[model samples]
Target: MSPSRVTYAPVGFGDYHWTVTDDDGRPWFATVSDLEHKEHCGQGAVAALKGLRQAMDTALTLRERDGLRFVVAPVAAADGGPVLPLDDRYALTVFPHVPGRAGEFGQRLSEAERDQVLDLLAELHGRTPPETTPPAAVEPPGLDGVLAALDESEGPWSGGPFAEPARKLLREHEATLRERLAAFETLVARVRGRGAPLVVTHGEPHPGNLILGDEGHLLVDWDTVGLALPERDLALLSDDPAALTRYTELTGRTPDPDALALYRLRWSLLDVAEFVEWFRGEHQRTEDTESAWKGFTDTLEHLATASG
Candidate 1:
């Protein structure tokens, strides 16, 4: 089968994506990302895609019941396979482009909008998945290795403008960083001891992943979706007490504060580590390097604040 005309989408970080138009002028979204980058996060491309497929299936199930709006799953190729391999460096998947504006991180949504989001999440958490779907494995935040990489790099650090700044920021924040690491370990132990029931979680449910469309709100970016304690999703919205209360009222599931704390710490640590790795490696010279450096520093501050 002939492929569609691909135009760069230029929307997200961490992946190369495009908007493709078929001969009939119907547009779809396509994503191409490095397999190794994903593997570094503790899951390879194949496993990540499999988990995404399962999560999309579950989301569709909830959509049918609650009128939940979500991004359409990647379409299988002519051979009936979901992922199409481009080469060793990149793999491809395509989906229907839902029209909407992406939400900003610090932007406040109105009460009605918040209720809609809570209702959607309640419906999602109430879903039951196939028995064959395994629970997501918990991986250490792996920030230590990232710190080591920064320490071992010999400088003149001039290969990238942000290189020296990133190294300095890491050193300045070292004590706070170590404290957050210890706090994460302690939180993990408490959460594990409680033995919360595992549910499918959209690992990163921040406003950046939400799309407010003509019909309703839609959650995009399922690459991190997997079977985990529901708190992993709830932690992102924990700033709003009313949202948390409404979720429990809607789903009849109690939220665990310890688990929510652990997940929030986990997000901050992982993000700081990822940005550091990106800044130190081949991505150092990219146009995004400066923003990446700022993000790393901001995340470190977030970790420090949360730890306190």
Candidate 2:
């Protein structure tokens, strides 16, 4: 099918994405992301796509056993491959449009909804890690590198709409940033030393990744699925005592407090680094300039709070 025949529109503020309807009237969601930008962010497209296919297979297995409520659709090429090469610069993947609303960050979910999400996570973590799934690459935080580049630049920041805000945040919060980096390094060492049990973590299980669909709550965005400490997924729900209780009650796994803290800090640092690169024009332009700038500033504020 020609992609041009489908009506395409932006889905969110990150990456180049579209909601398209095929000629047969089937709805699909398509994402076209720059390979170079993905590599710069520590995700090589080939490995990432492999992990995605592995994740989809695992999720489908769990769904068959009634252990999972979510569906992971891997659109196949004519030859039955999972991913389609859009061009030399970008890759494309299409998913059936889930008829549901995505959970929004900063919005409070009802007690029932929160419990449902916690239950879903419990099921996901309780699954056996697929043998084909590779271990996640652990990279040192990138904030230090971003800081170094900012320090080396001589002129007033003028890269893009996010440039000045990024500069100001980096300069103003230099001490906190340094402290957080050191703390993150220490935590990484401590966690590695203990050799915590590895499980299939969603990497990001926040409400924003949860879809309230007609059938049930569905967890989308398998891009970051990997074998990691269960706390990698639990950290998002750490602040909710009821959710924590539900998870432990359902999965019989206790979340390590230190690991939870470490994952939260790691997430904040990663977001800051990614958005800084966007401000520096390392990524292809897919989202509106103003929206991307606002996201960058918001991420900076989140980093400041996380570090503080």
Candidate 3:
């Protein structure tokens, strides 16, 4: 891997640090970065970089010994630190450069492609179950935590269409549905707390992680890895219901609505909190975190709408 020839893929800021090439052409990626939230996927995700690194390392070690598919191909550690495209107190891990393009991935695919993906999932799903040994428990943010995360000086959750809706929903449900929500919250926490047979995930198994290849859909983006909490991972698909059906069809099961709701709202708000933190630091503009704000609002609206 030569730095002179490497040009980063133009997705993230900081010089798109990676050389995208076929396996034959020479595949590699590397970078050094400071802990700046905005430069990463947004502020919300930035704070978790350290936790993400540990999770990835654990995942990689599991893969090496287990030989998983969804997990990428990483090398042994270098002298300085972990062998990866990054090592900035956050992470640095690379894979065998899975060949494929995002355009080719699909949840709503032709019969053949869908079947292929299901088969691949079945095979991958067989190797390891959700991880139980090292339980990476995700605690539901209590009122104090959620409010604290939302109370950043000028983060995304503020003064956006999202805030109005979220606040309105909270107000509306504060009294009528408080008990139900508390119960639901406990259920959501319990589900995640009850560890699963840990399997390798792309961390972020959204459509973005999908890569179309001869072998079928190869998952990418091992940023958020650990156990396969389908509720959490699957809720990432709330923005797309069709994908939910496809997932259900493939798994021969339907996801629990309450659990899905909790995961969606939790992550969506977490994104909001991150956006707020990022916006305060990066730009002093009103509309900087509009996307997250919009998502936050929409999540609230969707939940309110669902409740009605």
RMSD of each: 3.1, 3.3, 6.4
Q: Model 2: per-residue lDDT, tens digit, 260-292?
A: 778888877777676667666533344565666
CA displacement after TM-score superposition, residue 137 of candidate 2 (Å): 3.5
Model 3 alpha-carbon drift over 4 Å, by segment:
12-17, 20-25, 31-50, 59-63, 80-91, 103-125, 128-134, 140-145, 149-184, 189-203, 237-258, 279-282, 285-290
lDDT of 1 by residue, 1-308 (tens): 24468788778777888888888788888888676577422366666555545554554444544444563456666666656667645667777778888897756777677777777777666667544334565544456766585466445344456767777777778778878878888888888988878876667777888898887888887666667888888888774444588888887877887777787778788877777766665544556776677678789888777667
* Candidate 1 off by > 4 Å: 1-4, 40-71, 131-134, 147-159, 239-242
Which number leads on TM-score?
A: 1
The prediction achieving the highest lDDT against the true structure is 1
| Candidate 2 residue runs with Cα over 4 Å from true position | 1-5, 39-67, 138-141, 153-155, 240-243, 282-287, 306-308
lDDT of 3 by residue, 58-167 (tens): 55655666665555544555553343434444444545556677632124455555445544444454455433223333443334444453343233345434454454
Per-prediction TM-score, please? 0.86, 0.84, 0.62
Ranking by TM-score: 1, 2, 3
Clashes of 2: 0
In order, candidate lDDTs are 0.70, 0.68, 0.49
